[model samples]
Target: MFSLGNVRVRTKLIGGFIIVSLLIGLVGGLGVISLKNVGKKAEGIYSQNLRVVYILTDMQANLERVRGNMAELIYVKDQAQKDELKKSIANDKEENTNYMSEFESINISDEEKKVYEEFQKNITQYRSLRENVIKLVDEGNFEEAEKQYVPIRKVTEPMFISLDKLININVDSAKSANDNIKAINASSNMIMMALSIIGLILAILLGVILSRDINKPLQKIKMFGEKLANYDLNFDFEVTRKDEFGQTGGSLVIAQNNIKELVKTIIENSQSMSAASEELSATVEEISSKAINIDEAVNTIASNMQEASAETEEIGASIEEVDSSVIVLSQKAMEGSNNSNESKVRAKEVKDSSKKAIEESQIIFNEKKNRMLKAIEDEKVVENIKVMAGTIASIAEQTNLLALNAAIEAARAGEQGKGFAVVAEEVRTLAEQSAEAVKNIQETIEEVQKAFKNSIDTGNDILEFINTDVHKQFTEYEKTGNQYYSDADFVSTMSENIAAMSEEITATVGQVSEAMQNMAQNTQKSSEQAEEIRESVNETTQALEHVALTAQNQAELAQKLNEVIQKFNI
Candidate 1:
């Protein structure tokens, strides 16, 4: 039959009782041995009684030998026979005394010791009386020796009877003691045999009972486990005890019942799950298709953004072109202004040169008139020459002042005006030289007036021709006539400055255009990537929904199994 737990109750109780009883029996046997000192005392007394009996018998034998020698002395008439008998009697008496003393020393019953002492007294009296008879015989009183032997026999016969009586009593007591020892040994042997037999029987019985108790419940558990392994869903088991082993058995039974219910629920849920899984898989496929559509939409938006970025790039390029054109126009305008300034400076120089030519022609005419007058030594021509020299000196000082003003302006222009400053310094030096020339001319005119008065007429005619021709030519000139001519060096410096500024502007424009292009491209790319990320998140949400549904199905299956298990009493 099947027990719910791993072991039975009856077998365990039987084995436990048997173990206790065996332990008690072993203690009892030890107690019997512990209190056995009396038996040893009995055995010791028996041994001493045996030794006493032996000594007494040896003493009796010695006494008999002494009596026989006395009889032999009576029959013999020879002196040698009497002497030999006396010597024999002496040796026997010594041996008998030693034996009696030893027998008295032994520990026997008080009554036995009293009987031994009475026997010893009689033997001593008989020996003393026999010795008197022997003395009479040695004195040749044969009749008197025969009379003494009569009394010795009386003593000897009674003593021998008492010795035999003591021997018989000791033998009887020894026999009784030995029988008691044999009986005790037999009883102890019997007790040991009986206890051993009982212990063996109890051990065998306990073994069978304990084996059954353990094996029964274990067999039940094993069978249930086997069924569980086989996935049997209809089996139920129960345990109804309260020990540790019983509790284990009960727990196992519950576990088995739970497993059976669980298996049934799993089987049922598996059928339902198969259909749901198919629907879920189909739904996931639909979701994946929608994600693909969203991806396509994102791709379209990305393409449009790319086109917009490209349009912006083109617009930026156009703006850059306009900026470059403006830069070129500014450079050309600055160059024209620089050219106009140079032309004005060149025209001023030409005007100054023409005025100087007219002044020099007027001076030649005056010199000729003075020469003509000087032929008659005229003082008016000399005074006119001095006035011309003073006017030339004042003109030279004004030119030098103008040159100093130009030098100051050139100095303000730094390294760019080094050539202008050099030209201004040269003009100043020419003005100083012209002043010296005018002074020399005034001195020469004075010397001429004094020494070449007659040659003055010819000089006057040549002067008149030179003055008329120079004046005619100078009158056709205008101060602004050379205004159109520009200074090539100043124009070149302006062009170089313009070219450097244009290069800087061009580089800055190019950088601005490149930065704008990069910004537009990055913004477009970010918008496209954001749309992609949004699509990915939507897909992830759908996947999480599917997973949540799967987990919900598992939890529902577990609940159903719990309900199914409730049907069993186990």
Candidate 2:
């Protein structure tokens, strides 16, 4: 026989149900058998024995009625009354005969049939005696009629006794049959209850056995799954049964072994990659260092070339400036002779304009100074407002904190503090709103301070510009105007001197231009060499960058491999 443990889970569940069903069927079969026996006994009592008892009672009643009618015939003296009695007696005899026939027709036991035959013989003798008694009465021989009634009367008691005995026998048989039916029914109920209890117990036991058999393997599988989830691959999966759990365990073992081997290979490869990356990193570092050195040397050379180029440009610019000044001086000297009278007239006009301008500038400067002072005062006020806003914000924060403390105290008081908590929450909300308003005010004040500072800085810059550039230019203009007025007579002498200096400046400008040309050619040669070195450095830097990138990629790959390998236990 195959054990339950060896069966598959589906088969085990099915077997459990089948055993429970068999038990139920046994209970049903017993009930059916007992009920069928009760039905047979009930049929015997109701159909045969009880029916015979009812027929016996009817026959006895009819016999008693016939005997009473025959006895009434002897007392009847009137012809009409005697005739009525005789008719009645005849009808009674016919009814008794019919009852006897009915009794004989019924199927009965041999003992009951024998009793019935004796009853029929008694009834027939009584009917014969009753007929003779009626005939004696009809002949007006009342004495003879009375004597005939004696034989009829003698047979009546025996007939009644026989009928009683038959009724008693049938009643006894009915009682025995009813008792058998009751016994059958009682046995059926007891057998059914016992069988039902046994079936229920068997079902429970089978269910427990099947559940244990099923859950034990499942629990082991679940434990194995948990271990696998936790990366613990060291335990043994010892379930080797032929069921699904066994197959699953076998598959898991194979997978675990495979993962172990795979991880080992991955670890080895990751270590190898790590080592190679380190070596490559070192090589890249060396290359990067050398590239940096080359770049520095190239940059130094480029810097020197750039310095030389700048010096050449400055020398050229100086030569151009000198040449332009000489040309201007020569042109001015020629114009001086023609404009000396014009200069004297313009000199007076310039003097008047300079005094007017100085007066206007003084007025403008005073206005600007007063505005700047006001701006400074406003800046101070804005700063004070910013401070006040900060203080208000701090106070709001403190108020919020106090509200929060109050709320906490209220919460600690439980139900009694619910109303207080609501009030505290409202206070906290108001504090938060006040804080927000203060924050907005602070932000506005800060913006105003920044604007004031910017305005102050602009005013200072204006003042500085006026004092440095405008004031100096105006002073020089005024001095020049005064000098021109004073030097009106000496203009021709100055003009002659300026003509002599222009010739000397022209000669110096030619020599400076020639030197500038030589310096430019040398600077061009140096710039070309610097460009070549720079190109070489750039190529080296790119090569080093490529090597570094490759090393970084190798490092990242090694790190990822290590992470993957760490997921399995060896």
Q: Which candidate leads the pack in lDDT?
A: 2
Native-structure RMSD, model 2 = 36.6
Off by over 4 Å in 1: 1-42, 74-84, 137-140, 185-212, 257-570
Candidate 2 per-residue lDDT over residues 1-570, each given as its tens digit:
665555677877777898889988888898888888888888888877777777778777767776777777788677787777667766766776676677677778888888877877887787778778878887889899998898887888989988898988888888888888888888889889988998888888988887787788889989988998888888788865777767777888899898788778878788788788878888888888888988888888888898889889888988888888898888898688447757777887787777777767767777888998998888788788878878887888898898899999999999999999999899889888988988888888888888878887888888777767776777778888888976864785687678778868787887878788788878977887888888888887787788788888888988988886677666
Candidate 2 ranges beyond 4 A from true positions: 1-3, 83-87, 265-561
User: What number of clashing residue pairs does each candidate have, in the order they appear?
Assistant: 6, 0
Error of 1 at 14 (Å): 10
Q: Residue 211 of candidate 1: its Cα lDDT?
A: 66
Which residue pairs collide in model 1, if any? 5-217, 6-217, 6-218, 7-217, 8-213, 375-453
- State candidate 1's TM-score: 0.42
* lDDT, candidate 1, at 111: 84
